[model samples]
Target: MKLVLEILTGVLFVVEVGEGCTVAGLKDAIAAQEELPRDRIIFVLEGDPGRTIRRGEDGVPIVELGFRHGSHVYLFLEPEEDNGDDP
Candidate 1:
């Protein structure tokens, strides 16, 4: 299945998987695509936890990231810390 992902204040991408894809897989795909750090990214849906949607099993409804839809899905993006905090 092909999945589209969107980030609120960042970028969006699509994941085309043959068998199935989960939330974690989606995150991995995004990270792989942007070459960004995983810890800096956040995913959510409809103001709720995005991980819940991600953890859902096969056949479960998923938010297409890069689509123009209603308030069904929401993806937020925030850049992670680029360097260690000053002591």
Candidate 2:
């Protein structure tokens, strides 16, 4: 399955993998493909900040979560404003 992950005001990356690709794995995949640093990447799932979402009470890694086939995950580049314009 190919996961379509898009970041607001940034880039949209696609990941092709077998079944059972976790969110955390997806994150690593994106970083690898985009040549981005893991420390500065964040994913937003279901409209909530990925950092705030819990995998098992603790904050979850973007790679460890489950994604539906053809599902799209939204990622936000850290250190960049959600809105491009300065406040």
Candidate 3:
């Protein structure tokens, strides 16, 4: 199965994985392909807040999240928190 992912930076890429593949596996693949840090990436279903897939839920298979071949998903960077010390 091929999953199309659109990053926050407006970059789009396709990952070839099986339906049985876990979200964690996908994340690892994305990180390797983009040469990014896994901790900095987040995955969410396009236009669906309720379907946000967190790193903790990586064990869940892609099909379990309602994703099929050629599905399009959104990738965003984990937002950085603003500390009060920032002036």
Candidate 4:
């Protein structure tokens, strides 16, 4: 299945993975493709918290997590924290 990953900074990535791809696996793939650390790339499903996608769902398959083939995910890039708090 293919999914759209739209980074918070306006970068976009269309990734193709197996039906059993877990959230962690997807993040790793993106990290490898973008040459960034997996920990820095985060995916979040907006709206209600109950229905939102969280990092705790790492081991769950995206398909079973209600992610469609063309699901649009918001990828938040969390850079390392510094002495100064800046976005």
Alpha-carbon error at 75 in model 2, in Å? 0.5
Scanning candidate 4 in windows of ten residues, the lowest lDDT window is 46-55
What does candidate 2's lDDT look like per residue over 1-87, in tens digits?
777877786577787866655555655677788787655666555533333332342244334554556767776666743675766
Task: Tell me which of candidates 3 and 4 scores higher on TM-score.
Answer: 3
Tens digits of per-residue lDDT for model 4, 12-63: 8888889889988988888888786787666765435524455577898877
Writing each residue's lDDT as its tens digit, candidate 1 over 3-82 gives 45566655656656443454556556667886755545555554423342432332333344422233334455565456
Tens digits of lDDT, candidate 3, 1-87: 998999878899998987689988888899899887777677778544447887688788888888888888988878776777977
In every candidate, how many clashes are there?
A: 3, 7, 0, 0
Cα-based RMSD of the predictions, in order?
6.4, 6.7, 2.7, 3.9
The C-alpha local distance difference test score for the whole of candidate 2 amounts to 0.60
Runs in model 4 lying further than 4 Å from the true structure = 46-52, 79-87
What candidate 2 gets wrong by more than 4 Å, as runs, is 46-66, 80-87
TM-score: which candidate is best?
Answer: 3
Q: How does candidate 2 fare on TM-score?
A: 0.57
Off by over 4 Å in 1: 46-74, 77-87
Name model 3 segments beyond 4 Å from true.
47-50, 80-87
Q: Is candidate 1 or candidate 3 better by TM-score?
A: 3
TM-score against native, each model: 0.45, 0.57, 0.81, 0.75
